[model samples]
Target: MRLLRLPEVMYLTALSRSNLYRKIQAGTFPAAARTGSNSVAWVEEEVLAWIQARIDERGLPDTP
Candidate 1:
C-alpha cells in the first residue's frame, strides 16, 4: 500500500511527466491519488502490476 511520488513513478515506468499525464487522460495508465492540497501519488503495487503487465505483453501480437 505504499505510495510512489512523481519522480519515482517516472523512473519506474520510464515515462516522462507529460506522457504519464497523457496516459492517465487516455485511460491507459493508473490514476494518481490526491495526497494533499497540492500533492498526488500512485500506488506502488499498481505501478508494479502495470510493469508486469507490460512484461506479460511480450511476444503478443500487435493490434493493427
Candidate 2:
C-alpha cells in the first residue's frame, strides 16, 4: 500500500500536472489522498489499475 507523490505519478503516467488534474476532475483518473495540510498522494495500486485499464481499452475492438 504505497502512496506515490506527484512527480512519481507524472513519471509513471507520462502526464503533465494540468492534464492529471483535468483527468481527476473528469473522474477518469483516481483521486489523490490528503497526506498532510499541504500534501497529497495517490495510491500506487489505483494508479496502476488505471494504467492497466487504459491498456485494456486500447486492446478492445472498436464497436461501430
Candidate 3:
C-alpha cells in the first residue's frame, strides 16, 4: 500500500493543508495514520478515492 505525505497529497488533490485538516475533522475524508510524533501519512488508495468522489460530484475533469 502506498502512503503520501501531506504536501504531496495536497499537490495531488489541489487542497490546502488547512482545508485537508478541516475535511478530516468533518469526517469527509479519511484521516492520516500517524507514523511518528512528527510524521503522518495517508493511505494512497483512500486519498485517491476521496478525490474521485469530489470529481464525480463536481464533474471536475481528472487531473492530467
Candidate 4:
C-alpha cells in the first residue's frame, strides 16, 4: 500500500513529467492520489501492474 512520489513514478515508468500527465489525462495511465494540497502520489501496486501489463503485451504474439 505504498504511495510513490512523482519523481519515483517517473523513474519507474521512464516517462517525462509532461508525458506522464498526458497519459493520465488520456486515462491511459494510473491516476495519482492527492496526499496534500500540493502533493500527489500513485499507488505502487497500480504502477507495477501497469508495467507488467506492458511487458505482457509485448510478449504476446501478433495475429493476422
Question: Scored by CA lDDT, what does every candidate get?
Answer: 0.95, 0.97, 0.93, 0.95
Model 4: per-residue Cα lDDT over 1-64, one tens digit each? 8999999999999999999999999999999999999999999999999998988888787568
**Tens-digit lDDT track for model 3 on 1-64?**
9999999999998999999999999999899999999999999999999988887998767788
- After TM-score superposition, what is the CA distance of residue 58 in candidate 4 from its true location, in Å? 0.7
Which window of ten consecutive residues has the lowest lDDT sum in model 4? 55-64
- Badly placed stretches (over 4 Å) of model 3 are 59-64
Query: What tens-digit string does per-residue lDDT give for candidate 1 at 1-64?
Result: 8999999999999999999999999998999999999999999999999998898779777668
User: What digit string (tens of lDDT, one per residue) describes model 2 on residues 5-26?
Assistant: 9999999999999999999999
Q: Higher lDDT: candidate 2 or 3?
A: 2
Looking at model 4, residue 13 earns an lDDT score of: 93
What's the candidate order when arranged by decreasing TM-score? 2, 4, 1, 3
TM-scores, one per candidate: 0.89, 0.91, 0.85, 0.90
Model 4 spans > 4 angstroms off: 60-64
- Looking at model 2, residue 3 earns an lDDT score of 100
- What is the Cα-based TM-score of model 1? 0.89
Q: Candidate 2: where are CA atoms >4 Å away?
A: 60-64
